[model samples]
Target: MADRIVVAGVPVDTRHWIGGRRVASVETFTDHSPVDGQPIGEIARGGPAEAVAAVAAARDAFPAWAATPRAERARILHAIADGVDKRVEELAIVETTDNGALLRSHRRGVMPRVAHNFRFFADWLLRLDHDDFETRGHTNHVSWDPAGPCVLITPWNAPLMLATWKVAPALAAGNTVVLKPAEWSPLTASLLADIAAEAGLPAGVLNVVQGYGAEVGDALTSHPDVRRISFTGSVPTARRIAASAAANLTPLSLELGGKSPLLVFADADLELAVELAVEQYDNAGQVCLAGTRLLVEESVASEFTRRFVEKAAALTQGDPRDEGTDIGPNIHPRQLEKIDGFVQRALGAGARAVIGGRRKGGQYYEPTLLTHVA
Candidate 1:
């Protein structure tokens, strides 16, 4: 019941979202699930060449789409929000399958965040307008024009949520968009794109290009037609997009990698703190804002780490789809391998795993808690 089960009917043609239609028949790619090493879906394995074509499509659609009135755009967004509401269950299934996240997380966290996001951005459209003023000797005013078309790069950790953040704002601002979802998770993004189409959003106004970040993402950044770039991913990749965007002087919006730490003062509630800590590690630390590092007061570090390790040890692991499973496979096998390599090197250099530090299968990594990481 949670598989979206209808993914087979979803379009897989590596077509460009242009002028409110699907322009297919060129090239494509496959989308896989990290949890089981299964081919869950397919996407367009687009490259620099395709980027040129997609950007051209968006470029052509931009002026007209942007010139549309704010209220009209707002109406389209409201329609989109409505459509998303209808597809919440389906979207949640695909989301869980793609990222190996807890279904409850998607059902509760992802879907609601998406609904709130669309409506939230929909409301902003009402608040947007040009202002007029008078200077001492002459009239003075400032007006904002749509920044032409934008190419947004989203991440796998929080695909729909991150992409929605960019898509909602850009659409409300009257800018047409060309989005490249993380190769690791495109189901939700593709589904959202489908919903936008159903909502009657002009085709090229919101295009979905599913491919590698370097291939599809780079092309859009370097393409002259794309005037803005919004990327959410690793720092190295963000740096590349930023530098490339500079060539065209295209503006950028980036949410890059961060080594986040959470501090628990001695006076903090130990019970709640332990619960949240376990929850953080349960998702396999794939989330960007996850409390990857804990900076507990030295007085409580020993006791805190002990309880955290105990919780991590008891976490259930296996197929993400199982109801009783508390943990799922890492979203990417390579990512899991990377984590292993990092932890291994740290251990070789004296870091210790108080709880777990082993790879079970292709995508499943133990819910691990390492101490004294160097």
Candidate 2:
């Protein structure tokens, strides 16, 4: 392993944020930068015991948070949003260094959306309306109530943005949260805990536990005190979490995998279609919503393929920190191998490569285009 390099200006201790404080763990794991396979720092390796502690903290905080006025919750949420906005550059750097995401993408796209999530939910809570109905001899009423302590398990691909997607609404609804960010990309989530504290989020309102899913995730999902579980990740993992939550009759909100297809019609703008197709290669084509499958009208297929291949071939792949770098390394060497294996299998099964179709180096895969694919 490359020599461990602690990130300057950020907490190196990857302790769990429980009850408004940092808690230590029994073991530790080294977090390495996927960009160049160098050690970033060591993170606390938590297990079921840590998960139980986090859940307990959130459960203890739920009643008070749930009773807080909607307007008050909105104010705190907005403050958190502002705090995130002020630290966008710093968070983006951490995300890039830990997860192999391009700093440019995180700074300009991901971080802004993360802040927007909080802001949007903050305003949304205030706009909520109640409904009542009166009949000849009966009355009906509808209301929204807090769901108590919730477990939010975010994926590695877009750790901070997706975590906020779950965290913002949960907090806006006055529910305490136990967030278990994917172990591969926990740095930004750790920073978020600090931001929440700085924004004056009450003790135990938001707790973060860092560790592998099998240990921390299993414990959280199965904990009886956790009322709701929100997860975003692969379908297989979602299934496992679902089964575990089912044992406790817990409510679940899962956003699983997708193989999004891009359709191009003869009347559609060719340039625009080509551009959209090129986007499938973004984030090294690791995105769940990427348009990996293309369905084009036979009339425009030839032109679209030609232009798409030309554009895909021109994309720059290098260090994620570079200002001009278009694509960064994969999340790790294993993911790189997986992408390569899939392409090679397709090619062997009859698919033909029109342009780039090879690995660049240790963790970089070329922007690939394949035709006649089954």
Best by TM-score: 2
lDDT of 2 by residue, 109-220 (tens): 9999999999999999999997788989789887889999999999889999999999999999999999999888888888899899999999999999989988888999
Q: Which stretches of candidate 1 lie over 4 Å from their true place?
A: 1-16, 129-142
Model 1 lDDT tens row, 121-182: 87877876667877787887777688888999898887887899999989888888888888
lDDT of 1 at 370: 76
lDDT, candidates in the order shown = 0.78, 0.89
TM-score, one value per model = 0.91, 0.96
Model 1 TM-score (2 dp)? 0.91
Every candidate's CA RMSD: 3.2, 2.0
Q: Quote the positional error of residue 54 for candidate 1 in Å.
A: 1.7
True lDDT of residue 67, candidate 2: 97
